[model samples]
Target: MISTTDIIISICYIAFIVALGFWAGLSGKKDGAAAGEYFLAGKSLKWPMIGMALFATNISCLHLVSLAQSGFDTGLLAGNFEWMAAFTLILLALFFIPFYIRSGVATLPDFLERRYNRACRDWLAVVSVVSAVVIHIAFSFLAGGIVLETLFGINMFTSIIAIALVTGAYTIVGGLRAVVVTEAVQTIVLLTGAVIITVLSWWKVGGWQPVMQVLQDGGQLDKLSMLHSSGDPSGLPWYAVFLGYPVIGIWYWCADQTIVQRVLGAKDENHARTGALFCGFIKVLPVFIFILPGLLAYVLYKQGHLDLEVLRQADGQLHTKGIYSVMITKLVPPGLVGVLVAALLSGLMSQISGALNSIATLVSYDLYKRNRPEATDQQLVKTGRIAAVLALLLSIGLLPLLNRYESLFNGINDVISHIAPPITCVFLLGVFWKKASSQAAQYTLWIGSALGAGVYLLGKLYPINIPPLMVAFYLFVVCVVLQVMLSFAFPMQHTAESNRLYWESPLAPLRVKGWPGLANYKVLSTVLLLMMAVLYWVFR
Candidate 1:
């Protein structure tokens, strides 16, 4: 049962997000009904809105609940998912963003079609829409439902419906403008709520020093170590963490059309770059919010003062805490409990709004517009809004099925890691390698994705298990190797016309002008270096 105080806080939060949506709706209408104005916010987002929008869409309930579970299981080392992402962002800044902006494309699939062929575009669009609607949002909804049920003693099904209805109503009415504006507010609430929880956790656990001391006493301080002396027999291997993490991040930040679209839809490349950089910076904060709480949980367990019970063996090997419930019922107070609930909901809200808007854009622009080139802007917008409503219902329907996964964040990551690498491979090959042909691109994508899906399934089903991340890399390698062989065997049928066609398009690769002066490169590099050093120092 949600306390009345938390319920009140949640209501206030809903009102705030809806109000922002209304504000965006008002502003967006003043600009009239052009596709650019309604769907892309007139391509006028400043740095702050751009930054927060990107952050909001990227960070979801997975961060709040799934990431917390990872911390409980692996200590600080579990943060490889969040921290290793910086390298991918750097790659985007250096390579992908400039070319993407040059393309002047509204969506990633639009680039695919122009770069390769209609087949590539249509195939990728199918995959992208399915993944966004069925996999990403559904899995996230499931995870959010789990957190809601555990935290508030509410029915998971009810929570799922309620969240979907609220998110869908706003997104359907307001389009991208509402999504962006609401995302900004959601990001602020999420950050503030997390800080409050972290501060309170530290205070209750006798501050930073005593928290460490308790962890030491429990003989579980090794949880904080990034490097495992030996790979876990059951859990993700450390080598996979090192390589797989970066690969997954590359797909998400640079190649995942949903994420890159935010940058692409920016007013210009500079705004895109700045927004991405700000998101990269904000990405560093997960350790403080999610990971620290897991460490605090360990401290509470060791001291025998924890509000949640820790199951244990006769030999005293640590077992799982009811992580979802413990994080809420144990760590938070009454009024603040509502605050954290809102934080969890904020994650859910950002992801849903983003998917609703993006899926609609793809359906309207990439699919419907391509087929019916003569359709009016109003027709396209109406179709997009209808698609959003349909997608929302489908996602809400899947929330109940999400309970089957062991770890919510890990499950979603595992699924995305498989599907994403193949797409990323094609995009990278298409842009940088001028010789890449539609035929070669199509073959590589099919062969690579088939191999990836097969390997991932085998890893899951077989007793001699392999990590999903490793399977993704193995598939990536196979695809690249195959693309090279095929390229040699069937050289691209590049003609003067095709070359001209590519060059005329906005997304065509720019001739490398004298370095774009990555303003934050050194700062990001230093931060990554310090993080590595600190981890090694503590573990050593």
Candidate 2:
């Protein structure tokens, strides 16, 4: 049970967060509804804010709970999701951000409209908004609700509503700037709490070596390995890691509006690239900060301090899901529990706010203003705020469906695997292939989405043991083939605007001088690659 002191500290933290969000809202208000100010933070975010906001937005409670549980179940291999993201982020900084900035589009859909057609833009916007509300925002609220219910005996619905209200209060008023600035603060809280948890866990386990020794003694050495055989159906296989994971990573790191929006808010290419690189570096922390803590909890379970039934399945595997909350309830002291709860809330709120703000941006710019081209800046902002509220309501309404999933992390990944391939195919081909006509784009989306949905349904209906990542890779390949076939048959009927959206058509790639001779982005990219290589090597 939560002590009074813990309750009070948590309340205080919530109040402080609300106040910070309001301050940011006020700053945004001063800009007077300029779409750029509200949606993209006036395109003036520095590298630090951009980096922190991106990291915080991406590392939500879903990650904290799900990733930790995954580590408990599968060991370090689950961290491949976090570590492999570096490659995609580097690719984003190197190849995508420049074109995105040069196009001067507010939303990802807006960029699609520029590169492809208005129909493509509209289709993407609808898909994006629906996904944000249904998947991202709803799942975030569910995670927060689970935490609150588990810790404080709060009703899950009540917790969801409370979290929605607190997050929406700032997001509706302040927009992206408020979300980003407050997220920077939340990132600090999250990391601090995670570090404390990790350190305490390490101590409890009698250090890393003992933890490894215990797992080995238990004949669970497979859990210690990051790489698994293709025939090993238990954890992530090598084929999925190499081919499938990158497809999901590309869509998530490079193409997702919730993530790319922060990079879009950067002042210039240098700041954007720097922020992406910084976020890439930060992405590597989950294995230690979040996942290792889960591993520690498993250690405690093995040591008999924790109830085996709470964290283990009937099949003798770790349940992994709900293990993080179990760890907190069983392990953390009172005041620190309050702080860690706040950190968990911070993660949830940041992602919710980011999703809310991005949804708002999409509706305001892509859907609203398209019909009312002469709409004032204030009008767009109002629409965005209204859209955010509606999205929140929709998310709350969908909360009941969340209980069906055994693992929130797996649920999210499954959803992403199904939805991401079509959009990823569109964006990748749209940016690189000059002849990727609007017809091809439209058909690919239709065909790819159909294929993805079919795959998902088949998996649900049958005993399809293929990982979602591998399924996504197959879908992506099919989509790419469809795009190429259609593009060649019907040549692109490009207009003046469409012609200039490519990499070298009119907007040249941004070149930067490094400290010595190489480009700065290249240097950072190399560092990120090296770090990833070292991590995999050590873990493998």
Candidate 3:
């Protein structure tokens, strides 16, 4: 049970977050209350805020709960999800951000229209909005609801409503500025709380050696290994990690609106790339702060300090869900419990608000303004606010349905793997392949969506048993082949404007001198790459 002190602390944390959000929103109003200020923070976000907001948005309640559960169930392999993001984030900073900024598009769909056609833009906007509501927002609500239900004994429905109201309150009022400002604060709270849990859990397990010794004694040493065999059913296989994970990572890190929107709101190219690099560095923390704590939880359970009965099935096997909650309830002290709960709630709110803001941007700019091109700045901002509220309502309505899934992490990954391949194809080809006609882009989207739906439905109806990761890889290959064929058959005439949008366009001289050495982007990119390599080496 939560003590009086813990309850007070948690309530205070929530109130402070809401108040901060409102303050940020009101500050944004001072800047003109225009669509640019509201939707993209007037393109004035610096590297620090951009980095923190990106990290906070990505590390949602799903990462806290589901990723921890993954560590508990499948071991160190879960760390790959956090660490491998380094590569994709670097790609975003070095390659994608320049083009996006040069194109001067507000949303990713807007970029598609500038590169291809309005038809391509419209299709992508529709898909993006739907995915944001159904997958991103809904999953956030579900994860937050699960945490509240397990810890505070709050019912899922009530938890979802409470979280939605708190998150949407700030997002609908303040827009991107409020989301970024609040996320920057939440990032600090999340890291501090996670660090506390990690340190305390490690101390409880009598340190690293003892934890390793317990796993070794239990004949579970493979749990410490980062790479697993293809035949290893308990952990992620190497094949999936190599061929499939990047597909999902590209869509998430480079192409997704919720993430890219942060970079889009950057003050300039240097800030955008710098912020992405900073976020990449921050990404390394999850393996230690989040996953390791879960491993520590498993160790504590083995040491008989934690009750495993509630986390066990009738077959005497461990069930991974609710492991994080169990760890907190059994191990953390009262006031500190409030801190960790605040951290978890921070993750939840960050993701929901980011999604809400991105959805508003997508609908208001990409869809509504397309029909009403002469709409005033105030009118566009109003449309975005209305769209945000509607999206929140739809997301809350979908929360109960999320209970049907056994594992929140797996459900999220499966949905992304199923739907992401086509979108990834479109973005990759649209940016790189000059010959990729608008017609080819359209065909690829339609065909890829149809193929993905068929594969997902067929897998569900029958016992296909293929890993969703591998399925994602296969789908990507097919889309690539189709795009190449269609583009060659019906190529579009390229112009100077279209050529400028590509990577090698005349946005030169590309090199900018940094403080006493090489270019800033190159320096940061090299550091991020080296860090990623060292992490994989150490963990592997």
Candidate 4:
């Protein structure tokens, strides 16, 4: 159990985040009430802030907890999610960032509308808002509530309510500026705490050699493998990862509004590209700091250094959601528990704040302001604040539902697998194929979404034998074929503006001159790719 000191530290840390968030908001106030300032941080964010915010916003309390659970349950098998993301982030840096910066759209839906049609934009805006609420905000709240309940014995609902109010307050007032500013700080704290715990766990385990010996003796040495063979229990083989990951990865890392909003707030194209590549580099850390700890926890458990009875139910089935929490109490000392709780909250509220801001932006810009073109910036900002509160309430109510899945990471991704196929299909086609028609996009999104929903429900009612990643890949292929047929049926009459958006050829996006030396996006992207490849090789 956490001591009084831990509670005080957590409360103080929350207060600091609130104060800092408010400060960021007020400072941004002087920049004027323009939509650009409130929604996109006045388009003045540098690469460092953008990169850290991207990392922070994506690394929620859910990731910290669920990834550990995944680590304990499946070993290095789940690390593919962390590692495969590097490819998508590189795609974002090289291909997607240029268009996002040049287009100056506030949301990804707006990007779609410009690239496709208003119908595409409207469909995507609704999907974006819902996904941000469900995927980003609700999942984070559930994780936060779970952590609070575990360490301090607080009620999950009470914890969720408190966190939502605190995070939403700053998100409403400070907008993206406040969100990113606090996210940057949270990223640092999160990484520091993770590193500390990982180092401590490693030291306690008597170095990695002992861990290897334990696994080998236990006949669980395959736990160290990153890529699984066909028929592996994890259901994630190398082929599945390669084919399936890109389908959802592109949608999440490259196309999602919640993650990509930071890129949109960049000072310029170079900053946007470099920031995304920087985030790709940071992506290499989660496998070690987040997932490795869980692997270490398994090692400790086998060695009788930790107990996980709390993670089991009366029926004797393991939930594993509480693995990371159990590890925190068992592994770390007393006073540092406060810092760790603060770090959990850091992941929690940073994700909430970022997602809430993006939801507000999508609501105000895509849904509200587009209809009321003459609306003032003050009015747009007001609408956003209201939207943030509503989104928070909806997310809070969704906690029980979100908690149903045994694995939080897989649950979120399962939903993503269903949702991302059509969007990914549309985006890939829209950006790469000039012949991709607005008509094709409209029909593809509609028919493809219906198909995805049907497939998802089918899997739930009578489980689909295929892994979720393969499902996503197959769904994407269907959408691609559907769109291509639709495009041929209804040829595009591209506007001059839409024509400028897509590359004429595969090499077109790379033709533009990047910055000099190491900062060049091309240089950064290449290095990131090589680094990821080497890591994969080592792990394999």
Candidate 5:
């Protein structure tokens, strides 16, 4: 059950978030403003805000709970999800940022139309909108409900509604500026809380040496091993770690709007690149803060220092059974519990607001006005706010359904893994492959979606015992390969037409200005390669 202190702290945090929305929402009354100001914060974000926004948006309740659970169950293998993210983030800063900014678009879908055609743009927009509704927003509500139940002693349905209403309140009012600014504050809270919990866990365990002893006794000492262990069930096989994780990470950091919007909001290209690199550097620390608690929880369990039986009820099941962060509450004192709960809420609010805002941007610019160019800016903004509210309702309704999944993290991972391949494929082709046509783009989207969904359903139905990660990895590879084959087999005579229709405007693409140092691509690639080598050496 949640203590009174935790509820007080949570309520205060919500109030602070509402205040931020008030500050940002005041700007909504400005007349004759460009969409840039509303959707992208007038492209005026600085490096610091960018970093926090990225961190806050990316580290949601999933990390607080599911990641901790993973560490508790599987030990160190979960760290790969964090440390490997650094490389992909750097890759995004280098290879993708320039193109995204140079396109001068309000949303990723707008870029798709500029690169492919209206059909391609519409296809991506539809997929993205649906995914936001069903997967991203819905899962976040589910995660928030879990947080509430664990910390507030409330039913999941009531908690879901409460969380959604709170988050959506600020999001609808404040828009992008509200999301980013609040994210900045929340990021600090999240980091401080996580670090505090880790430190306390160490001290309570009688320092590192005793902690190690406890972990070793519990058969969890090797949890820090980065490489797959032959004896381990959850470990990613060696091949999958290198190829699979990278692609998935790239798909997330580079193409996913929730992340890219942070970079896109940067005041300039340099800030965008700098902000991304900074976040990339910070990505390496999750192992210590998020995953280690699980190992520590296992240790506490082994020593009988913590009572799991008491932690459960008549069912012989733990409260918040699959939530990893809940372990910390049982181990920590009241004041510290308030801080960590605030941090968890911080992460949750950031993701919720970001998704709500991004979906609005897409709806307003890509779908709402695409066929109705006569709509005024005020009208579009009104529609955008409505979309935000509707998105929250969808999330609120889906939260309970999500709680039935085996692992909250696994449920989120499955959706992203399945959706990413096709989206990544078409976006990559649209940008770099001069020969890629609207027809080819459409075909690839269908083929990739089918291939990815088919593999997922097959693995589930057949009980193949293969990792879902493996299935998703192979599915994407096949789609990309077959897309290439099919494109060549039915190559059309639209080279000049494709170039005319799809090529980014020369001035727009070349708008980037700076005394170029090491190309971001070279710097990012080199750094990631070195980091991978070091990680492999350690893991090996």
Candidate 6:
């Protein structure tokens, strides 16, 4: 049970976050409330802040709780998502950052307009906004509500509302500046809480060898491996990971509005590039701290170190939803349990705030300002605030429906697998192949979206045996074929601006000069790539 001290600590931490947000908002008034100031934090973010904000925004309690659930159910296998993200972030740093920075666009849709046409921009803006709502905000709310309910014994929807209102109150007023400042602090707290749980669990389980022995004794030792071959029952084989991950990873890491908006706020291209690479390094932690706890829970239970009776369900299966909270209550001592609660709330609030700010940007820039090109800064700011409020309300309403998924982590990726292919294809070809036409991209996004939805509906009606990763790969293949053929048929009519966007050769982006010493993006990217390879090799 949570003690009185725990509740007080939790309340105090939340109040501090809200106050910090209010301070960030009030501080920004010095810049006089320009649209750029509100939407992109005046484009003044440095590398460290941008990196932490990016990581914090991408992660939610969904990651802490559901990832632990995945670790318990599977093993190190679920780390594929976390690990594969490094490659995409590297892509963002080396190739995508220059275009984003040089073009000086507020939203990705604005980039689409400059690269393709207004039709492309308009379509992408709608899709990006919907995606920010569904993928980023709604799922964060769902996972957060589950965590809050587990810890406080409060009604799930009630806790969600209370948290959302608090988070939104500051986010609507403060914009990206408040979001990122709060996120940087939240990231530190989140990492510390995760470290506490992991260290405690690790000590309780008697370290790696015992955990291995427990799994080996149970005859499920395959749980220890990070990579699997084609015949592995996990369905996500090595080849599928390589082929399928890039499809969704490109969309999530490189092109998604919510995730990429932090980079958009960078003080310069160097900051944007290094910030993304910095995030790549941080991605290495989730597999250890977040997912490993669940594996530890499994190992500890097998060794009779943990009692998981509360996780038992009426249908004779484990109720994995509350597993992380169970660990907090069981293993963590009283005063510190508040730290864990605060950390969970940190993830929930940071993720929602980041997405809310991105929604506001997309609305103000892509939806509202474009239509009213003559709109004042105040008008655009007001429009964005309204959009953020509406977006939060819509996401709250989606919680009950999204709560039905058995595996929140898997369910999220399954939805992304269907939604991401066309956008990924468009961005990839538009940036790499100068021959890619505006008409072709517009048509590909339109047709490919319908095709993916149709496939999803068909899967529901029929027994489709393919894995979600493989499904995404196949959809990407079809979309690529359609875009390639259409591009050939329609031939691009690139202006001087669009011509600067694509490179002359594969090595072109690498030839550009970066910051001096080890901080150079090329240097950092190389080091990160080597580090990831070593990690996978050791875990393999």
Instruction: Candidate 6: list runs displaced more than 4 Å.
Output: 30-33
User: On residues 305-409, what C-alpha lDDT tens digit does candidate 6 reach at each position?
Assistant: 788888889987888878899999989999999999999999999999998999899988988988899999999989999999999889887777777788998
Candidate 5: tens digits of C-alpha lDDT, residues 256-335: 77678888888877778778877876777777888887677766676777666644668776653444545556777876
Question: Residues 1-540, candidate 2, lDDT per residue (tens digit)?
Answer: 688998898899989989998888676655453788889988989888998998999999888988888777777778888888889998798778877887777889888988888888888888889888867788888877777887878898998898889989988888888899899999999999899888888887888788878898898877777788887756469778888887888888888888899999989878888889999999999988988887787777787766747555678875556777777777788789988888998999999999999999999999999999999999998999999999999988887776678888878888899998889998888877789999999888877887888888888889577888888888999999999999999889988988876665422444545234343777878888998999889888
Write the number of the candidate with greater lDDT, choosing between 5 and 6: 6
Off by over 4 Å in 1: 30-33, 310-324, 494-540
lDDT of 4: 0.90
Residue 402 lDDT in model 2?
A: 69
> lDDT score, residue 166, model 6?
95
Give, for candidate 5, the lowest lDDT window spanning 10 residues: 501-510
Return the TM-score for candidate 2, rounded to 2 decimals: 0.95
Q: Report model 4's TM-score to 2 decimal places.
A: 0.99
What TM-score does each of the candidates earn? Answer: 0.90, 0.95, 0.96, 0.99, 0.91, 0.98
Q: Per-residue lDDT tens digits of candidate 4, residues 419-538?
A: 999999999999999899999999999998899999998898998678899999999999999999999999999888899898888888889898999999888888888998898899
Model 5, residue pairs in steric clash: 76-223
lDDT of 3 by residue, 278-397 (tens): 999999999889888888888888888889687678999776778888888888988899999999999999999999999999988999999999998888888888888999899888
For candidate 3, the per-residue lDDT at 187 reads: 99
True lDDT of residue 333, candidate 4: 90
Higher-scoring candidate on lDDT, 3 or 5: 3
lDDT of each: 0.73, 0.85, 0.85, 0.90, 0.73, 0.91
Runs in model 2 deviating more than 4 A are: 31-33, 308-320, 504-519
Worst 10 residues of 1 by lDDT: 506-515
lDDT of 2 at 323: 77
For model 4, state the Cα shift of residue 275 in Å. 0.4
Q: Write the number of the candidate with greater TM-score, choosing between 1 and 6.
A: 6
